[model samples]
Target: MAPGEKLDPLPDPFILQPPAFHPVVPYVTTIFGGLRAGKMVLLQGEVPLDARRFQVDFQCGCSQHPRPDIAFHFNPRFHTTKPHVICNTLRGGRWQAETRWPRLALQRGAGFLTLFLFGDEDVKVSVNGKHFLHFRYRLPLSRVDTLGISGDVSVKAVAFLNSNPFVEGGSEYPAGHPFLSESPWLEAPCSRALPRGLWPGQTITVRGLVLPEPKDFTLSLRDEAAHVPVTLRASFADRTLAWVSPWGRRQLILAPFLFYPQRFFEVLLLCQEGGLQLALNGQGVGATSLGQQALERLRELRISGSVRLYCVHC
Candidate 1:
């Protein structure tokens, strides 16, 4: 990227079957095939309630005593009155000039999601569904071989997502799996697979507040074969709340409708035998039959409407 050029949110890259990391504290994991552009790493964890700071490092290797060359250091300091994300590189036993991004994207004592998008010019990071920081590279991508995170943080999972293939049968899109852009949180026209992979008993919850007097919103769940098993539609335009296949041969399902304009609410779609159950805030809204396809085959969630979605979890 040119100096001072704007870095927009990264477009969705193809995701492989997310390899999981459930490491002990002071974690260090090697990147077996090395890092490059079009690859991203997802770190999910919680900062301690009393966390003063924590650090994540992209190192040349996982060596200690005389630590390996640090290609990128991400340190978030909470000790100061105003928090900042500190970025730097270490080479020849000296630290480079540090860059501070004045954003405290991590929440105290709560889980946070951080995505590091690797590119030729810089590494852009997003935290908890929002853009956080970026750091220009001071080392070639070739030298980095390990990833480490340490200090006052409880890590839940670390996943390395590589979109471009450099080896035979590498971590690319699986043959039969449905693929699409990763969902941009709170952004309409959003869609992605359930990150942990959907299961039979899992409940998919979408929580959002309507943007003051919203006209309409729609959320859909689809199977691998492109079958939309269940779809929820809320429209003030037509004064209707309906389920999928409105005009198709399949019958439509309607719920005991209620509206909370300009207020927060959650829609829970639970997968179970016979059909999908819909619940608003905690009570049953309705049920819609999605045929007899296996639960594991339901692979995608698509949401697009005039609303700001805060969370979608299964």
Candidate 2:
């Protein structure tokens, strides 16, 4: 082997989009790119030990002055001996007739994952990855772009994922071969839109090759207001992986640097209730915490620096 030889660059991984980790209770964030069929919103957290009830609302906006419209209001009541869930909508600040589901899918002091899958006519809900129920949309899904969660729960993460990428965004990929479709290799220093925004249980995978004379490269998840939720910086010279929080604080990891000059690498970022978990080449790296930033507002992915990108999937 040559003493000063460089390896070839590598390919990227599939991104599951950005996700919000360990968000505060009573959380509300704008849903960028709006709602559509084939998209799913995931919530992972725990019900408080001494909790009574909680509510998750899909609203038009986060306006308090006039009170924005609520397209879907999912309220779980533990006040009664037999817990139940109530689904309703609020339009013009008036409550509509509620539909009640007698079954309670969550319990106190336990972690849970709730998934909301959007469809053309209704939203199918599941708990712990199993189908629970379906609710017909009282209002158009497009009108609901804000997600609000409140009361009696400690949220871990929130993720917005696409189950059917071929049908999304009018992609030119043929529907007959969904599994064979891969995005074309994108250039570095590029930005991609996260149509629905981040939530819990979402994963974003990045694959690229570190340049022969690499310095550093960064991947950032930002929102419409320029608020960044998470950023990953890989420094070749320093041999470090820096996890930048939403507050601009850096938590540098110095144990193992996964990037090498002209080497292809796949980095996976998983959004959980606690934080974002990093994995390099299928090995666990570490995690970083997010501030009180609303992850759903993180609608853009920006990648820059010394890496040559192969592709990005979100």
Candidate 3:
């Protein structure tokens, strides 16, 4: 694809399946897969109270899989609490459960069981054979401090099993998951060669917000077609970037917002002479103009190599 060309939409990575049960302890454990690969349930502990007992639970999707995938329950009534599950998908995103199970009854001889089942288009939960909660969408594989069960029972086993192929290989958070360092601002790299055609008065503006960080980073805009790079420097200490017009000027101030490594950032570029406009995610902060001087000489716009995640005008 040409520089600045649009990209296709992201695919869903969640697999559907029946619910499963498992046993767990007070420590953080993976009820299913590693990292954010398949379906993973995480567990933790919290303050103890004199209320009904509940077993913390983590559930997964069931649109594809037909069997109970995984489960984890804690032992030692008040001795150990705070269990959670980290539900993840093959693509990205996560959900967490941390509510205590209400003081309820279970099937005779049945201990407190935390279930993760796939129900219709949502993920449902049941404790001691009693229905509790349901999630409408697939949860991404991320860390969460939620997942509680309340009842008059104790946890026993934390099992992991799946009858579906789609949900087997993917883990909740595999050890080899890709990692991107934290940054205050990011920019999509430009192409090396400018477009072949030319049109005077053609202009494009690239804009984005500054992330919340202690230091500032340089935002570089490259005209891949022209093989040029324009750099903008800004700070993310305050966490905001507003729009600043750069007409007939070299640099402009964009919006102001705290940088969040977990959230999506945006950038906007307007191409008037060409009758086109492009907005991108991860384009970096600040504002600037690609005036008729150089934009008129370009044919293609694209993000350079290894410059971080890039999303086209969405």
Q: By lDDT, who's the top model here? A: 2
Against the true structure, whose TM-score is highest?
A: 2
Evaluate all candidate structures by whole-model CA lDDT and list the values in order: 0.68, 0.72, 0.34
What does candidate 3's lDDT look like per residue over 1-314, in tens digits?
36995433322222111122232433233332322322323121233344233434442332224522222333223333443323322222322342343333233233344444433244454553445554544443333223344454434333322212212332212111111223223244443233443343233322222233335434333343444344433334343333322222233344333234332333434444432332233122333345555555555544432234322221
lDDT at position 255, candidate 1: 41
Q: Each prediction's Cα RMSD?
A: 18.6, 17.9, 18.6
Off by over 4 Å in 1: 1-18, 163-314
Query: What TM-score does candidate 3 reach?
Result: 0.26
Q: State the lDDT of candidate 2 residue by residue for 86-114, as single tens digits.
A: 98989998999999888799888888888
Question: Which 10 consecutive residues of model 1 have the lowest summed lDDT?
Answer: 173-182
Query: How does residue 229 of candidate 3 score in lDDT?
Result: 40
Candidates by TM-score, descending order: 2, 1, 3
Question: TM-scores of the models, in the given order?
Answer: 0.50, 0.52, 0.26
Lowest-scoring 10 consecutive residues by lDDT in candidate 2?
A: 172-181
User: Per-residue error at 288 for model 1, in Å?
Assistant: 27
